[model samples]
Target: MGVKIGLTGGIGSGKSTVAGFWQEAGAALIDTDAIARQLSGPDGAAMAAIAAEFGSTMLTPDGALNRSAMRELAFSDATAKQRLEAILHPMIGARARCQAEAAQAAGMQWIVFDVPLLVESGHWRERVDRVLVLDCSEQTQMARVSARPGWTSSSAASVLAAQASRAQRRACADAVIYNDGLDLAALREHVLTLCAQWRRCK
Candidate 1:
């Protein structure tokens, strides 16, 4: 496909901000979270497998997967998270590949995969031409999450704990975008620069 960049970061680390900048730079973006949500929707292929494995309780009254329930289950049980990933990750990856192929065929300059769990999954490393990490200190992350309308520190901590450590993510990243104290403008500039560099490289 085109020059595919894997954009990732820990929870509340501005991964979405980086992705938005990539979009502004004219890169085709495929967010795995969005694809996962679609695959968990009513009539989606993953719904049947999930129902078969976890029963109807995992589904809502509208026949869609209960996202809140799944979130809680995943956080409380490691096996449950693995089981859900096993059913949805492949489908998400397939859709991402299809999008990347289409973008390449259309002569797009780059494709950005906004995958928050890229390091955790490990399977995506080889699929990407480069790995871009949007990084901030854990303290900054906690502050950002705590300041959100409905977020609590404990919940934020749980989400952070589920992902790869900050040190580990930084160690594996091909490029880093430090967003600790920067505003949106600065973040955009960093992403734009990286996008330019990546485009030139390929």
Candidate 2:
């Protein structure tokens, strides 16, 4: 297998941007968040289970998971969140492993498993060769997320509060990219440098 990197960061920490840089540099990127989104879309693998657990009210008119409604429920109810994870995590893990195996078979030098909750999940550390964390301050996180459409400071705060703290994420990181004030070009340069380092290590 190639160098497997578990890329993670807090919400709005620009983790996706970093992952994009690595993807463009030829790393096979398997994003768990994107997979989860697909699995909750219309006719998704997790949809029937989600509907069964939360009923039709948790689904949209088109039969997709109503993310907004589900998010509200998950945040307010711990059991609801656990139930959702129970349904989705196994599916996500299986898909991710398959993708990684395919990437290794295709002769890829790097496989970047971009997971939002890499540290919180606890099991991800054993699956990946390295943990790459994108770091930024709470204020930066709030500012970035608040600028998005339909997101308020309170909403961003709540989401941030639910994720692992910056300190905890850093503790698990084999490499950290501090993106608090860096521009896109600088971030790309950082990623490029890291990619070279990972290639050398491999």
Question: For candidate 1, lDDT tens digit of each residue in 22-134?
Answer: 89899889999989888898888799999998899999997789876776887788899889889999999899889888889899878899999999998888898889988
Give all TM-scores, in the order shown. Answer: 0.92, 0.97
Tens digits of per-residue lDDT, candidate 2, 1-202, equal 6889999999999989999999999999999999998899999999999999999999999889987788788778889978998999999999999899999999998899999999988899999999999999999999999999877888788889888999999999999999988989999999999889877877
Candidate 1, which ten residues in sequence have the lowest lDDT sum? 193-202
Clash tally for model 2: 0
Task: Go through the candidates in order and give the C-alpha RMSD of each one to the true structure.
Answer: 1.7, 1.0
Candidate 2: regions farther than 4 A off: none
**Candidate 1 displacement at residue 44 in angstroms:** 2.4
Score residue 99 of candidate 1 by CA lDDT: 83
